[model samples]
Target: MTTALIRPTADLYDSWAAAVNEFDGVHIDGSGLQAPVVPGRVTLDALIRDAAVLADTTVAPPEDRVHNDLYWIVDDREVVGFLSFRHTLNDWLREAGGHIGYAVRPSRRRQGYASAALALALDRAREIGLERVFITCDDDNVASARTIERAGGVLQDISDQTERGHSLLRRYWIAL
Candidate 1:
């Protein structure tokens, strides 16, 4: 029941509101949207706005770019588990955000959703002509590291991402 990234329909927004209200770990999938966002009905418009930067010549070219949202149909409802991306991991991106991000609802974790979602996202990344992509996880996030490993992610470096007082960042790379 996966659908291409599109404007948030009324039904989709309503479902997203309900799911995220009760599920803190479940992030709204916005990679599929026209821009980068937290993936929620509340931020849809803003996300679209950020994505508009792509139209500027100052930004990188738009080829081989695809954003994706990971939605899980639970009890006949669409519960967004996480969002990932298939895009260019520029120098800045390599240092911080990497190429993907994901989260699973606390109540729905340990059920393999993140693993499945990431695997799917990586497949899409390969389809977009990425020979390899960088993905970062918190050093303490064993679950996330395992998910990356399952997707064939190889450890690259562990750097302190505390410039703004954040935690350690572990970088990995996966070959398509």
Candidate 2:
């Protein structure tokens, strides 16, 4: 298999449109994920602009939000997954979310795209000077836990969060 590449969305809206339609126009959880393709690419253009603004560390978010960067995990110019790096953890994130979040297209699962994308995300984290990055997966999501372990994540603790739909969360930390 050809190696996957991580790139920001630019002129790839056409390719992205196809992926968006693959899920019948439902916007999934990924930075610049699927959205309805309107005439003239207006929606795509707006998404691109928002992604750029989100990447800017200088801009401060409301008290609840944290800094983050969004990236697409591409292979052969097709988007297979997306990775979002939370530059720092807020209190809510520390207990639940974490430093990074990612989701591979259902059709591309089990193809090693997730692991590769995570490695790429970690490189970005290191570049940003993070000493350790926290990652979490639902306890029931064995595949996700395996992906995390493959990327050098060490088991830290299990957090219970039934109220959030995640019955139990297995939190891990990767040392940079």
Candidate 3:
């Protein structure tokens, strides 16, 4: 199946909601969705609005945040995952978050969605004139590490100190 990244929209709410439900209490990285996302508590309209705001580079991000673009990873007509591309790294991002973040829906794992999305994101980074992008994954997340490596990500080092709620993080840099 061909995978593509698109901005979040109201039209894909049903599929997006279903994917969100599949997350349960786990964090859906790259998805700008707020935590403890109860089904009825979050509306498609509100999410769409928030996504728009996050993607608006004209608007200044908060002191600790950087301007970012959020994209839903779609395969066919299904919302299979999400990706976030930060235009610049903040101090916290420099340590852990990196230039991009993404997550494949739990049900869609191991189907090449993430790898495809990462490849596409690298293209986007190049388009934006970035020479390279920094990425990080949990030290225990072997699958993600492999995904990064497959994308030509060179391992920098693993940090054991806590940063942005992650204790052990493996950092990499992917040259565009």
Candidate 4:
């Protein structure tokens, strides 16, 4: 399957919603969608609007957030995952969030979509003139750690304390 990252669009609402609903209350890390997704609560128009706002650097972000580029991971015409590339790191990001975040739909996990998407994100990061990027995953998420390592990420350190939804974060840096 041909995997690519595309900006979220209204035309793919049905496909995106289907994949998102499968999360069953789990957080979709990179999706701009609100956490613990309430089925039927997120409208397509709202999602499209939110995505536009997130991608618009001119628009000031909320106090605790940074401007980010959000993309939907598509395999051909289906939305299988989401990714967020922060333009700059905020305090929280420096501690845990990192420069890039991503999540594959439950059904799409272990299929290499995350790897392909991360590779694509890295290319975009380079094109935007980033010298390197920081990334983190839960220490227990062996698959994600492997994905980052495969992308040339070197381990920095693991956070000593739990932050947010993650128990312990494995931080890595990929030099571009």
TM-score of each: 0.70, 0.83, 0.93, 0.92
State, as a TM-score between 0 and 1, how close model 4 is to the true structure.
0.92
lDDT of 2 by residue, 44-153 (tens): 67766767776778888646777778777788888776778888999877988889888777788899988888888898899999999999988999999999998899
Candidate 3's TM-score: 0.93
Estimate the Cα RMSD of every predicted model relative to the unseen true structure.
Answer: 5.5, 3.0, 1.6, 1.6
* Candidate 1 residue-wise lDDT, 1-176, digit = tens: 34222223445666655545554433233233332234465565544454454423355655544343233333235654545563665555668677777666566778777776677677767777888888888889899889989889999988898994447988999999
Candidate 1 lands at a TM-score of 0.70
Q: Write the per-residue lDDT of candidate 4 for residues 1-176, one digit (tens) a residue.
A: 79999887877877988988888877788887777775453565676677777678777986788878889999988999999998889988998889999999989899999999999999988988899999999999999999999999999998965536568889999999
Write down the TM-score for model 2. 0.83
Please give the distance, in angstroms, between residue 119's alpha carbon in candidate 1 and its true position after superposition: 1.0
Backbone collisions counted per model: 4, 0, 0, 0
Span of 10 residues, lowest total lDDT, candidate 4: 38-47
Q: What is the TM-score ranking, best to worst?
A: 3, 4, 2, 1
lDDT of 4 at 106: 85
lDDT of 1: 0.61
Candidate 3 regions exceeding 4 Å error are 40-43, 161-163
